[model samples]
Target: MKNDDYSDVVMAALHVLEESGSLPNIERENKCEKRSDKYREEGNIAFKVGDVNRVLEFYNRALMFAPKNSRAIQLAYSNRSAILFKMGQFRACLIDVETCCKLGCPTDIESKLIKRKNEATVRSEMENLSANLLTGYFKDCFKFDFKSNTPIRCASSDIEVMKGDAFKVVAAKDIKVGTPLALEDSFVSSNSEKNVPFSCHYCHKMSEPDTM
Candidate 1:
């Protein structure tokens, strides 16, 4: 219903309950439940249409209006986690997942939420691993010669190529920490998929969605 119609209906119900001497606390709880359900429904509809900002807005409202320790509150957290994960905010997603579990999410959906948590954990770990790899000193394994080849691939004279069980890039010598490694230009280039509108296609820099 439109806001005006919904307000009229709620007012009518409150009038009837007041006539019958319903307790004030009971009326407040009823109103809270109805408002929570309304916002959650709006969030779900926004999610269906991929309106991420609106979805978060409605779900936040749902959480605010939902009673503490209620299933509706848990469901609001659960739904928000889904979008957070999709948006690659793994840490935020994990926080919401834990909140859902602590709130006693419905048994039927508990396993699904756990699975999502595990996936988010893996993604989080992968990101950490990548950061560590980039932050530390990189070994200068080889020095390349500018000789041309038949296939025209970038090759180094210091290293010999051989077929093995698996491909590996091993350091030629043990290096100490805080060492400066050789800097080279990236020979290969690829643009990211347009699925992430908030990040740049070329440099992978993050920007406001409105800028897109």
Candidate 2:
């Protein structure tokens, strides 16, 4: 469907949510979560109104404000998958089914019956790429206190370097600790033409200006 048509449905859903005081109640606090539910309801209403595309649009909006709201995502996934399947998009339908399984969305009796009837219809069409074989340039940053002597550690990935506030480069392997880090001769001096005075341990590039 056209973008404008989707936009109109989204606006209507928002209006419904607002009228229902889903976001907030003047008399009460902590009612924002209900906003997402209201949108999901509106999505169902749109579906009944024969606006399949609008139904999808509203469901997506509801999911945005409520990422962990499995029910909303499940309904959207199931309905949209059926719609896509009707449009000859079998691959997309399988994807939705897989997503539903991952989220542990319980299938209703009707849905389970349908699944049993079409047991062999769904097939895995997703490609799995091994992370071990992938390589790419990554930009990351971190904050370090000049006075602190203790090493800072990241839990997810091995940090390549400690650069600045709120960011850090991460790698698959553990970076050798206590390894001698080389600095450009100009880095020690107050006067330097280089944009980045500090050298990165991972790429070994001096690309960012440093305070020290």
Candidate 3:
């Protein structure tokens, strides 16, 4: 229903209840919490069947009706975090897990929330690192040279390789097909000659300057 229509319907119901003096004595918060629990139960059923979209829909409805700072609201956020994690939305999952912790999650579930938050943090960091490595800036700054024992060789001249893009590995010399390329610890590792630590010497995890 439209917002205006729903408001009208609620007003009409209030008027009827007032006239008949039949309105229940329950508090609005209690009623909303009960309704939210009903939706949460439905969402749990959807989760069991691996229906991601349906679970999200039902959980969202539960959140809409859950009272602020209530257990129901905390539970909704916690449940949604799991779904986000499964969908590979690590940042969002971390946010939800943090919210659940702030809302004082039950002792039984607090440990689980902490573990989920840690996992999301690690995944988010790895994703950010991959993106940074794929950027043109990082590619221009670092040069990847294969060592003498390396199976695959860098054909920078023969191949028109673009910066910040994935390129096919070509052997320096003709070899049989399906040859395994050993990329582990084969590069000549070196730190910047400058007196400053511009980036990590190994993983290239950058750190902000003290001036910042």
Compose the digit string of candidate 1's lDDT tens values, residues 126-206. 988987876663433333334432232443232234459976444334645643334356777665543344456767676
Q: What is candidate 3's lDDT per residue for 1-212, written digit by digit as tens?
A: 74545878889999999899998788545438989999999999999998877787787788889999899999988988887677666777887787888888978889888899999999999988888878967665454453434222433222233335676444456655544334346466555443123357666654442211
> What lDDT is reached at residue 177 by model 3?
59
Give the clashing pairs for model 2: 140-168, 141-167, 141-168, 142-164, 142-167, 196-208
Task: Name the better of 1 and 2 by TM-score.
Answer: 1
lDDT of 2 by residue, 1-212 (tens): 64546877888888999999885656633324466677778877887776666765675666565546456556655555554454334445566656666666565734652572254254322111222223221211222222222244323333345658866645536647743223123433432322222345444555321111
Tell me how many residue pairs clash in candidate 1.
Answer: 0
- Ranked by lDDT from best down, the candidates are 1, 3, 2
| True-structure RMSD for candidate 1 | 18.9
TM-scores of all models?
0.50, 0.35, 0.50
Deviation in Å, model 1, residue 12 alpha carbon:
42
RMSD of each: 18.9, 20.0, 18.2
| Comparison by lDDT, 2 against 3, better one | 3
